[model samples]
Target: MADDASFPAGSEILLLEDDLPLRKRLAAHLRLHGAEVTEALRLEEARRLLRDLRFDFAVVDLHLPDGEVLDLLREGAFSENTGVVVMTAFGGVKQAVEAMRLGAGDYLTKPFEPDQLGVAFSRCRWNRRATRRDEHRSAEPGAGAEELFFGQSLAAVRTQLDTIIAAERRLERRLPPVLIEGETGTGKSALARWLHQNGPRADRPFVSVNCAALPDTLAESELFGHERGAFTDAKRARIGLFEAADGGTLFLDEIASLSPGTQAKVLTAIEEGTIRRLGGTREVQVDARVVTASNRPLDDLVAQGSFREDLYHRLNLLRVVLAPLRDRGTDILPLAHHLLARIAARHRLRGLTITRDGEARLLAQTWRGNVRELAHEIERAVIFSPGPELDFATLGGAPIPSAGNWRNPAWRLPESGFSLETAVNEFIADALRETGNNVSAAARRLGVTREFLRYRLSGAKEPSAPPDANHPGG
Candidate 1:
């Protein structure tokens, strides 16, 4: 396998196994398969290798000399590109489940055939390559910036854009305090910028302050101007973000992270449209629109008593919920192309394109890190992609399944034998894979209509397949 020209040339892999014979055999096998293999006898060595080198995949023994393989998975030592396959002599259903939950790409029992390892490697490699291609496609030039959201579903896109646009328009009227809620990397800041740019106060300054980044002691002075000599370090009178954004817009990012006292000041400013500088008795009337963003639901925070209900209601006047990347399938491709073009232009590199397989991979995964993850992946691909075409093998990991990992045989199948429902689901999955997950194509190939295929897909009584190999769609 080491001398096989068909295998990926120069790809690096990390093999973590305490068994010396097994380690050597795997290393030789991978090297023969055209991969550069690094061996680790202990978990510490594995960690050191991960820190020092970028590996495309890792074959880990469930138990190590110093620790368990699950630790590495939990710690995210492997970049999203690194595929992890856990093998153990004592492998059981429980161990596999635990490993999968920790993000292992696949699980193999001890004494398995070397060919099985090869298959796992090949599958992961292919998945990574497909992901890279999608990332390249997403960063293409002149693509709308809206691709920051994932998804290809037209309804999803329209609904999100409508909410964004509506919020923007509403913010123009009274500059009512606005709140945005979504998971991390869901483009909350981007939406905030859009509101600032499109709102009535577009010409005014757009000031942003991250509540989480500021010290609680400085937050008050940061939001409201501080007079000289107000504090020990006060050297000169300083205008706060609210004052700076007067006649403009103030974006408060990570508002949920603000301290209670700071939240009180914020509430006061929003309610009165006036701020009193620290050490100054007089109030400074400021006309600024406030846009606050939080990763958590403000209602939930309010209920938990971490966030103030009054403040929540004030900011919630014009609320917009940014959908997670997984929900915006329609935007995935466009975003990927847009990001690629921007990256290529920024780096002065030749343009890159995505293949059909690449598109399919992009649309198939759940984007937990949302647009930011997609952006990083695309940027990395632009740096490593050979020539003008982005290949799928470079992506480095399988697409996370959108429906979650309910399909693993250990989890979904009955012990005695395959259930009738599971059999039907397996058949449909095979058909879908064969047709590259194109509903119409799969339906035609399977001698069924597209609608029928959709029905079966939605109603199938089996665990959903994992996303089509963690391609760079999101």
Candidate 2:
């Protein structure tokens, strides 16, 4: 298995190529780079090796003597942890996409340089880790469905994050650790992901874990790693989060839960750029950017002696805070609408909306769970809504009666201005459709006279007042 980060050095690799001279040269190159290479000249020989031994990575040609490599890919011949890089002379966009979709980590058009092979293997490693991360996220409940939404109220926080990303790009190596503090369910994990996706290593892996979820006995082994026979039930050696996230970001949510002993090791890893696996003699180097989040303020934890003061100071250098949802008064409605849209689309529902009363009910809540609570409320409303309007009957209050007034005092114009004319037209059109194009009914629904509605529908200039107060259906 490959313990070293980035390249394939100090790992086992399988080199599969049909051409004799090319195979020998490639094997020698990989071996020179400190990798243990096993060479196979045919598909049958490769299959035999694969069945008999476990390899960390495989560099295989597309067309083998006995069969095509796609056969093996479709059959899932490679282990889940084995990173595979395919080389082909007849490579195209479609072929590459197909190969990756099947199971291959990376695709390469052949007649390439030896250096490119190393780079491809590096990409393969990242791709494999990323795929595993995505699969794990998908398997968890309510994961990947919560999109990051930073509305007008979060504008300053967004600006600060952008500044941090800019600073990160300018530095060549060793990105500084970032600390995110917020209440539970305030989207701290989402924010960490946003930072990683927008930073210099967007193409690299982003590994995430909840420190609070790790049991006390396994915390150190999970974060650092464990060698075979390190403890009871230690079946095999494994790479930890730091090594898996090499050259990218590692997000630790609820980091305050780590024990003092584990915290010291984390600090050492961050400061010294190395970690020693449990029951292992040599220290392995890792360069994963650590981004940690805490539900409670670390300052309080440090004061109580629950957290290490030195580690707190180190992470406090680059910090961003997320305000609770209740404090973001103006952001409630827009955020609810965004959540509504996503929930509706996922259930194959359309034209879903929040009534004025529903909007009022949403704004009145304390939102103790922040964005997470809001999302659940929206999903519940979608499930119970009898029509297009979400009245939020689950909110436990009688619906507020409409006063036939369209102008809402609570509605504030967004920082980015909108097209008033287009908005008005869309509202009128929607009313007309609901009323079966009955002009009088649409006018009544809009709290306007029939004459005014017809005038606007004709695309005429705004009338100073009603043309005829006594007009029919006025």
Candidate 3:
């Protein structure tokens, strides 16, 4: 069949099909329409090509001589800059369902029209390009940080920011104790710093301490200072963090970790505005604003009799709850791009960008670790990225099974004579099947090295092969 003449020119394609005649025909048709085509007869060859070159989209056959195209799908091989269209001659409802579950961008039955393939590829490319543009704009500093934090959601982050700003304006006399609650790595510390810098105490010192890090025995002296010879290590008088932060702000991270004795001292200091040095009679007044943060709900801790009720009420005056990254879906792409730019700048690279595939992979992840994990991943990608633009390979691979699937398998395990090795092998095989034999994606889902997977595959008897006509490689 003739290719679609209306298809855009110069699109790059990675074509994987073992059948020489079909591969040749598709390449010729695509080339006639001004596309650059790379052909691979084997899944391994396609993976190698993908590692070295970036493609606008990929066309993968469902079955291969040695394995299934689903293996490639599982590996997230097309996760970077390419959209994928899976073709199957032996296609069944089960196979199509599994292919889509494994992250196939599009699936087609055999004997499909060339024009249909062109349209699918074009749609994927267009969407990816548009997403990249949107990410770039949002990642630019000051373009969407406010919108990122406030406008996109009905979450109280906007009101919280406004409250913080108002608190800063009123910081000269007395600033209420500010309590921030969030899961770890949700930018609680960053928000605290922003409040500190933007508030009236901007000129004063902003001291921070992790209450959880203080030794139970030394917590009192750490926060209220100690006179010489007060304890075994008290060789001389030393100023506590509270005294050091006078006229500024004191951020106590993980405040819920404090011991009951320490909590009492902290409550006293907050209420009385005075703390006496250990072994000293004189009470020194402290004038620092207090900002406390905890990863868990302090009220829950109070209910459990772990955290002090009085301290909880005292710190709850101006509360701000930072949303976890996964909960803030609108911010994911923007954050990814922002982190990419920051990583690029830090690495001294110019005009670094995320490819459409890269952004899609980023969006596909659950980001259980939140912004911190995303930032770390981007930093790694920047270091390993081959070109100015981050590609699919840089993403390490698309997450094989969606988090939900991996957490809750739709299928049941075999009941009889189950062995750990057998179970593992079965799981790997199922994952490969689900992902259309995508190795990288299988590895990701299995949480093992691709090399390890290769080793395991080599030891096992060859899996049942699909028909050879449309299968890519043997």
Poorly placed runs, candidate 3 (over 4 Å): 1-151, 392-474
* Error of model 2, residue 428, in angstroms: 23
True-structure Cα RMSD, model 3: 35.7
User: Which pairs of residues collide in model 2?
Assistant: none
**Model 1: how far is 2 from its true place, Å?**
68
TM-score of each: 0.53, 0.64, 0.52
lDDT of each: 0.70, 0.80, 0.71
lDDT of 2 at 12: 80
* Candidate 1 RMSD to the correct structure: 30.2
> Each model's RMSD to truth, in Å?
30.2, 11.1, 35.7
Model 2 lDDT per residue over 271-338, tens place: 99888877666666778899999999999999999999999999999999998888776689999998
**How much is 277 displaced in model 3, in angstroms?**
1.2
Q: Which number leads on TM-score?
A: 2
**Model 2 / residue 229 / CA error / Å:** 0.6
Query: Model 2 misses residue 54 by how many Å?
Result: 15
**Number of the top lDDT candidate:** 2
- Cα deviation of 378 in candidate 1 (Å)? 0.7
**Residues 145-239, model 3: lDDT tens digits:** 21133334324676666767786686565578889998987777777776787778776666667777788888888787775567998764555
Candidate 2 runs further than 4 Å off = 1-142, 398-474
